[model samples]
Target: MDEQLKEQLVLEATRMLDKAYVPYSKFPVGAALLTKNGQVYGGCNIENASYGLSNCAERTAVFKAVSDGNTSFDYLVVTGNTDHPISPCGACRQVLAEFCDADMPVLLTNRKGNIKETTVAGLLPGAFQSGDMV
Candidate 1:
């Protein structure tokens, strides 16, 4: 992705941090997904009373894009409050593999402006996909 776009995505993700609904862990997370067609979608983590029902920011952004009829994605940016960058959870990685190419870029960032870049395959080596079940 271009530097300009990447910066924009990071900014958007960072801005979304304020919108996270974290009444439990109190760790706010935000995600921004850039579509292949140049559209960007942002999402903030939302917590529920039932821990199992809580949704990660990454999945929220991905689902939003998918719901809007978008499947192809260029990259994803996630922001959190740690000093170092924060990566997506296991569930989010699986969901990403379901819709994104293995080589898709996953950018992690922290409130301190630190960034770490990885790919979907890097996060989930030998990830289980639908074809594997066939």
Candidate 2:
């Protein structure tokens, strides 16, 4: 992905983090996804009293896109307040793989304005897919 596009997506994730509804862990997270057609979607983490019901930022963004008739995405940007780049949760990673290519761009970043870019395959090596089951 282009540097400009990566920066833009990371900005969106950072902004969404400000609106995160995290009460339990108090660790806010946000994600921004760029669709193949160039549209962007963002999501903020939401926590619930029943922790199991808590939703990750990445999945929330993808869910919103799917609900809006989008199935494939080109890039995903994730942001949080940590030293190292934040990787997507297992569930979110699987969801992304289901609708995207293994080489899809995944930009991870922290609040200090540092970014680490990698592909879906890098983070989730040998990630399970439908074809793998059969």
Best by lDDT: 1
Q: After superposition, how far is residue 30 of candidate 2 from its true place, in Å?
A: 0.8
lDDT of each: 0.94, 0.90
* Candidate 2 residue-wise lDDT, 31-126, digit = tens: 999999999999999999999999999989999999999988999999999988888888888888887789998989899877788888887888
Q: Residues 30-91, candidate 1, lDDT per residue (tens digit)? A: 99999999999999999999999999999999999999999999999999999799988999
Model 2: residues >4 Å from true position, as ranges? Answer: none
TM-score of the candidate numbered 2? 0.94
Q: Which lDDT value does model 2 have at 114? A: 77
**Which residue pairs in candidate 2 have backbone atoms (N, alpha carbon, C) closer than 3 angstroms, thus clashing?**
none
TM-scores for all candidates: the values are 0.97, 0.94
Instruction: Give, for candidate 2, the lowest lDDT window spanning 10 residues.
Output: 91-100
